[model samples]
Target: MKLTVVGGGSTYTPELIDGFARLRDTLPVEELVLVDPATERLELVGGLARRILARQDHPARVVTTADLDAGVADADAVLLQLRVGGQAARNEDETWPLECGCVGQETTGAGGLAKALRTVPVVLDIAERVRRANPDAWIIDFTNPVGIVTRALLKAGHRAVGLCNVAIGFQRRFAGLLGVDPSEVHLDHVGLNHLTWETGVRLGGPEGEDVLPKLLAEHGGPLAETLHLPRAVLDRLGVVPSYYLRYYYAHDEVVRELRTKPSRAAEVAQMERELLRMYADPALDEKPELLARRGGAYYSEAAVDLAAGLLGGGGSTYQVVNTYNNGTLPFLPDDAVVEVQAAVGPQGASPLPVRPVDPLYAGLIANVTAYEDLALDAALRGGRERVFRALLAHPLIGQFEYAETLTDRLIAHNREHLAWA
Candidate 1:
């Protein structure tokens, strides 16, 4: 099968290439196209991709190009991993929000809104191009603000599914702690993208016995430590929250921590420089160890599984993905995109029925879903008022003063990207 990666020039591409090479039995990729506007970075990443595949004896042909249409043309599946404004814009997204005394994150709060606005339009344009090229192709979005971007693609009637490494990362961790294979640990993962909880950890299948309590009873400390949350909180909540939840559960503390550290964007920029230098080494045939510190751990596995399932190849039957809720959460609108465990196939993903959500998590999910609605509006029809309203609606920046300030800063820092601004 043919596959295309729109942001194949990203430092993260080598990790993905490694996965495609190793998991050839799962996805069986033939032609692999790397599409990027940054020609220099694309060549560097492309060369490493080819070497990695060849080293593994995988026969996928690696092609690199700046033309989006040509790169995606007739592809079986197209993965979107592009950053509309690169790390510099991300630095602004992570920095300016902290000035409002709010959590500075790329996927939630004011910063997430900025990313959604900048990303949605670009993703939609690419989706349209892919649609024109191959109407049957599935669009797998690995971009940040995935819920908003995936919503944009689906609303525009594109065949798409959103993938995140969070669920797979959790599964792998839980499996290691439980002394079982990752596939045997099924997470009752639910909620919106980046804002989710592992309500249960079942073994064998979705209907398998729930071992979450056992996990918490034995491994709560390490789990909580990974989430950067106190063990007491996990015991009290009785569910493992994603690390991103730390931003919400400890907003002020997170903001304080963020203020003291360099933006994640800055750190990643430095890592990318080193990674590029490494990627340029002709002898480097594998993803560098330093790339592990660059994040998106297990992203390759998740992408492979999702793409395989979507294309009717051998893949995990059930996986966590972001797709239309379709009433999986009674509290959320059916059209709202939610991240949950779903049975994936050629027909697409259908989220499993979830037990009644506790009011604690349901309330927050509902609140963020509303914020995402406004974020998408501002992204689709940009205006100062729309941007301000979206920021005002976010649970993290609910105050008008903070919202107004963040809105102006967002537009100011991103004026070149926002067509209406």
Candidate 2:
């Protein structure tokens, strides 16, 4: 099987390719294709792939090209990590609207919606190419507005999975903080990609049943120490969620509670700074900068690592991913693409549809759908007015009267930018 990675030019390209290289010995796929509009990064990624497979004498060929078709043709799996418009464009998405107190972010607030508008077309175009070349290959996406893009692919009737390092990574971290062995922890998680919850955590030992309940009553426990969140979700769920989930839940809750909206740039910048600095300290003396860089605050799925577990390692592996709901949660409506637990094996993935989320969790899920729908709308139609209204519905938007004021300002403020279509 030939595997292809789109946006092979990303900074994370080397790690992802190397991560998958380990899988060459096990999985059926043999060829590697690295595709990117940027020829140089594509070559660099392909070169790295060649180097990794050098000793194995594998059939792998790290072909690099600008032609979209060559990248996806005859592939068994395709991974997309596109930064569609690049950082400069994303920065504009953040800074332009903040002038009016209505911050725009790439995947959450109006800013994210704007970026979605620009990205959706490009993603769809790539998917269409994959459809003609490798119809059955699973499209593993690592793009912002993951839910929005995954939904679009489903709407077009393509097979794919939205993978995020955030959900599973958080589950294991929470387990570690809770002092339970990672092998024994079973997580029942739900919500959108960045926004999710560990609704349940059951340890393996006989005392495991009571561990979650006790943590709930205690309000804050040792497990809470690992979380960097706004509401203490596990505290609210009666347990602690992964520290990464804190990113979305904090934003989700602030919009729910105080009704004040903070700028998304401030959120990303603050967290990025903290994470970057944390890894930058003394660890540098031992490992080379490249390996340290990924461990250090860079969000990556270690796609190859996950592939190993899901392929045939024997232990049950499951993760909540951005995929069409397919009625897993009865109340969610199959159309809503939610991240939920799914069992994986060699044949492929089978999402577990247990029951509807509680009314409270349902409410949170609904809020995410609203935003995702708006992003899809803006993305496909390029309607700035839709973006403005989406902002008006945001939990963060209604909290402040200035939101409508800012909306009007944004309409006028971004007249040209909004009128691009």
Candidate 3:
């Protein structure tokens, strides 16, 4: 088995490499390629990846390349984790939207739309190159604005599946709380990427008894605190919202908080500098402790599971993934890419039928899905009107005045990345 990582220079690569080392039995990788345009960072990361494999005594060979086609040629799977513009650009994404009184984030709201515009095209081009080299290869996208990027890939007729660590992160957290194996806990995770709710937590499988109420009854306060939501809200909703929902539930408060603190991108940029320095060290054979704080918690496990299920032919095994709705949610269009529990196999992922959704969650999901549609349109078609329409559609930026201001900010901050700007 061969796997390619498109943005191997990212500080997150070590976490992925650590997973590849530990979960080699599951993925059974023979040749691993690290593809990146940043030669210096790639060399450091590649050296560390080799050291990681060597430390584990894994037989898989680590190769680094700046050539996308050569790196992906004949690969079994290609994982997309590239940031079109580095952290400096991300800092801009996270700061500009705040000027419009919207929560500036990399994967939601106006900033998210900006990222989608920049990311979708680059990811699609990479997908096209991967298809040209190996038509059968599966594309596992871990890019920001995953819903849009995955939808773009799927729409372009690529064999792609979107992977996010949110479900796995929740599973591990709930398992720790329940004193059970992570795999033994299954979540009724619903909604689109970065916008979801855990309506039910079951044991063993989808049909297992629901323990979500029990968890809330016992650990509601801690759970709510972790999500930065009020405990009363969780008790009232009888569900756990992903942390991203905080942007919606407390938009103004979050914008105020963001105004006071440094952008997440700035913090990450500092972390990357330290991590790259560590990666350049010959003695560092394992993933550094600092990498854990860099985030993408459990990303490697999620990627391994998806890749193993796809390449290893693990059929009908359920995993939470981002894929076509295909009527999984009766309220959503079939082509809408949603994040939910799905059975994984050689055929790719197909979401399981979702139980009926409460109007509270359904209303928001529908709203965001519509915004995503416009976001994708702007990402692909590229126009100020589309950007304005998407911002207007976004629940967090619904005012026409806010939309207009954000559209200009989005274009100005991203002129170099946007073709039609």
Best by lDDT: 1
Tell me how far the alpha carbon of residue 379 in candidate 2 is from the true structure, in angstroms, after superposition. 1.6
Compare candidates 1 and 3 on lDDT and give the better one: 1
Cα lDDT of model 2 by residue, 320-358, tens digit: 567777777666667878777676655455677554477
Model 2 alpha-carbon miss at residue 182, Å: 4.6
The whole-model lDDT of each prediction reads 0.94, 0.61, 0.93
Clashing pairs in 2: 104-111, 105-111, 105-112, 106-112, 117-379, 234-239
Tens-place lDDT per residue, model 3, 172-216, is: 999999999988998999999999999999999999999999999
Stretches of candidate 2 off by over 4 Å are 25-28, 55-59, 102-104, 174-184, 203-226, 230-233, 241-302, 305-317, 345-349, 399-420
Clash count for each candidate, listed in order shown: 0, 6, 0
152 Cα displacement, candidate 3 (Å): 0.4
Candidate 1 ranges beyond 4 A from true positions = none
What C-alpha lDDT does candidate 3 achieve relative to the native structure?
0.93
Tens-place lDDT digits, model 1, residues 1-421 = 8999999999999989999999999999999999999999999999999999999999999999999999999999999999989999999889988887988888889889999999999999899999899999999999999999999999999999999999999999999988999989999998999999999999999889999999999999989999999999999999999999998899998989999999999999999999999999999999999999999999999999999999999999999999999989999899999999999999999999998899999999999999899899999999999999999999999998998889889999999999999
Q: Give the TM-score of candidate 1.
A: 0.99
- Model 2: worst 10 consecutive residues (lDDT sum): 279-288
